[model samples]
Target: MTVHLFLGPTLAAAEAAAVLDAVILPPAAHGDVYRAAQRGATVIGIVDGYFEVMPAVWHKEILWAMREGVHVLGSASMGALRAVELAPFGMEGVGAVFEAYQRAELADDDEVAVAHAPAAYGYRPLSVAMVNIRATLAAAEERGVIRPATRVAMLRIAKQLFYPDRSYPRLLSEASATGLDAGELSALKDFLPEGQIDQKRADALAMLRVIEARLSAGLAPKQVRYHFEATIFWDSLRQDAAPLAEPGEGSWMQSALLDEARLHPVAYPLARKGALTRLLSRALSDEHTPRPLDDETDAAILSFRRARGLLHAEAMEGWLRANGLGAEEFARLMESEAQVAAVQRWAAPHISSHVVDQLRLDDLYVRLWARAREKQRLLEEAGLADPDLAAAPLSREELLAWYAERRGEGAAPRDLSEAALQAGFRDEPMFVRALLREYHYVRLCEPRER
Candidate 1:
């Protein structure tokens, strides 16, 4: 079977003897790992502590291999480092590295341990290599990399390195006596950064690659693409803003539309029509008659409503006034026209007959108008003055804490609950959660729980 190996610049000579059909070196010589795989070479990588130092780029490479179903192996130097990282990517292989100075290995002219010597850290020279081998085997069996086994193995190795017990410490100390120093041992921190295990960049990139692979393998494009876009947008926004709680799921725009629909269906349609007409008019002229609303237009309106708070009663009233209807004229028109019958006929094709019968269109319109007016008044009152009442821009941390608080206390606004969160935010929880987890100052948990 064809395989890809990633080798460190230092271990090129030793890895050259491997039985693979071809080899590719790291600090990528010419084309990237993807191009190497395309050329039918089994890619091998060797490096020192790649997991700790170059995780973003390294993880991307692993994801490319896993996505393309390319087999991978590494050893010695960075090979050992990569082996540990590859556990989560479902790569497998066997290799060795120099023992620490304190280990029981004979010293060489280079001051590194002999190839066959036991590692100073109480594990064999191939400990990291063995981890990769097992990971690969497990992935092969499962027919997918980044499986539960990979996650578990990666986590296990991370925990061992970061939270070693007495025996491990003693073993490491002995290994250090041979040659390994605090610097080398400390490199283990690459497995877990900043004490947070779940938010590793490798894991995030791996998950993204897995999802992309699944999508390419015949998953529905519409759903997959939508989710991908949403994830990217949320991540971008999180990066741009300081950590703060995210607004509820539908986004301000979406919630605004739903609120408008619930409060004033007839008024909503009119306001929507007026908004479109005005937008078009700005592009053309006041005398221009906009084209009839189409499905695309409806969808755009809905999307805009979700993204921004639009279609409130006050806004609708302003729209109506601009369209030549005064408050008194609007009231007269409602009172005189057969609004219920007109709405029922208009909604017949789109909604159930039973629903049309159940709904009192006239009453809904009146109630919605009143509520919209009230909201408009509130907005007016808060305008440029009521700082606390206004919706302030949140930092990334605040957004995450807000999300966590909602998650923990089950107090998320109706519009921003789990289902809505998934729909609106998609895969952005990690980035959002990172900010919350990193800054304890951002109070995401409910006060009572804290």
Candidate 2:
């Protein structure tokens, strides 16, 4: 199994390589685990990660990877935090720091957070973490270098200091100024030369050893007990990771599309909004095109193959190769095409070219959306006087009557079924459910506005 280790500060790349000869990456940021999983790494060991500099790795992405059958292990820094959070889902947590987190001995993230040098410096530690300070103080107490009370005082001082400003000299100086006995401070300073503990480094090394042992043992991928949900967040990550359209056009990705929208606001903002509306419609299962039968899909595929000179199995394989699609994916594409055809057939009659042209000329979408918002605001303001009226449910008969009263108006549909269709409500229950909501709003507004 190929092992990918993300490490920094707690362990250098070269040092980590000696312990486990894997593809070593810098500290993980958001989406790194998802990318690693996409690249087909069988095992992922996360020892360090950035938190404050940017968005931390999302837990959903890790859960998605585990669902994809990748064995993930964590320890030391950010890894320890993530491991404990996801431990019930089969993420392995190694080292004392991880155990501390699991046992609830360590709570604050600042306990493991520290400032470090850049990648050029192999992520050399520039500040001490609270965990390391706690470990050293515990060791000092064991050896009688400092009394238990003095150690507690020193630890409190260290913990209170910001992560970037934490160091032994600063910690000891603070202890002296804050009522810790001078003799105890002196003893701590004396013991520091040999008693200081690099607990983060130790935990990081332990994680590496754990990963190395697993590699040597030829371990199989761990089975997760829970089923992974492909939530909206996880699906977005998958979409963001798709290969670019061409060599120089940048990635054909959702993030890139958002960037383009931001860069050229006038050109893409409305387009992005439309795309999102459609996507949300799909998510709600309100805009699903009809799917053809297996025989129909097969016929469509065969027809396309013949038209493209891919009549033989070998020729079809070559076409699939050129298109970078596996056989299964190609089959799915044919099925999708059939669904699209059904959608076009179903929509062609409803799509009036004259209406579309007039709407565009009038900038109807912007004006209509704004007017709708205004009406909603006015209705809500009026309803605020009687909260019980707002909470009251409207019956189906009331909804139909309200629709009949507002027939052919901007807010209500000329035909009730057409109204449901335009609203992207697939079922009658949902359509009535929505109309009941609108009925209350219209009824509340009529008294005040009229």
Candidate 3:
């Protein structure tokens, strides 16, 4: 139930701390929110974030955090920008800055962008944010400190400068060029101390108060309707941001495990292809490996654990720990499986077009071709050419038992329907049909006795 807040020049640490009991951190950048979410922050408040000279906080990561059940809220500066864009997706936006952005009154990001000093210097403001300038000028005019035309001239001057070069001194230094009322200009300058409104700061503080109140009232995790797609990029980020994902007590990384696998000739190529599928899917940038429907992912996960005899919670935990994988990583593996299955299902009909070519390349053409020819001849002679399982006149259990016996396996599972789907059949009926064919074919091949 801890809350993590990213704060910077928008609001000083002391001011934010007074209103909210939060683990305050520096302004956010790419991956910061993700790291916070992974660190178990139930609530995250973003006030200021770096956008230049460093990668900006990503929308995808923020969306990912919310999906992970962290209540992510934003306001002021970069937070306002992100909150406005992500509002429809359940990111809570607070304060006047958020409201202005939501209403479309503020369009350019520079309206809140400011040049600030380093963290050691408390992220001291080196330039004025345009939003503050606008707020200040309007306030000045309201109090008769300046005329209406003076406000317009000042706003235009401020807007013309780049964000880093914007400051009160620079704005006033160029005021003589506009040929406006000298008296009004001087009064506006004097009034800026009292009349200037720091909108970004105000909004940041307001957001802190909102978080405090929500915490007192018992906050809930953010809920999302959309499923988060775990592309390879996401996997990379997760690995990079993890708290040193080690294999056992050996301090071994996953790559070390992969290297060990690569040393084994038989496992290398298969492992390589599995890794390659993940990479190839990512390469198709426009079509990120699509996330399967929730039910599909859940079913795939269940099937995977069942196949590995890891259905129990304790067994599953042990397996994940042995592999240096967490719950999220396991789910990601299931996602990849689902994606591959989905693609294979779509391409199933076109598979026969190149089946022989593949078989030939693998040096299985001669034996397979011969077996197919003989089987067809024998089936035609026996009048079993279009063998249909529905009319096979055998019970489901009899067919399953007969097939399992021939395969030298134990009794068939109780949930044969699930097993069917896992084996790529459309349903239990189709699986039964295939089993019946294999059963009769095997018996026919048995040498006639006595």
Q: Write the per-residue lDDT of candidate 1 for residues 276-380, one digit (tens) a residue.
A: 644543444223323323322222322332333322222432344444544444443332222222232233345544443544654565665575565445444
Ranked by lDDT, top first: 3, 2, 1
RMSD of 3: 24.1
Question: Candidate 3: worst 10 consecutive residues by lDDT?
Answer: 280-289
Q: List the residue pairs that clash in candidate 2.
A: none
lDDT of each: 0.36, 0.73, 0.77
What digit string (tens of lDDT, one per residue) describes model 2 on residues 211-230? 77877888877677787777
Superposition TM-score, candidate 2 onto the true structure: 0.54
TM-score of each: 0.21, 0.54, 0.54
lDDT of 3 by residue, 86-128 (tens): 9989998998889999999989988988755434445556678
Model 2 lDDT on a 0 to 1 scale: 0.73
**Model 1, TM vs. native:** 0.21
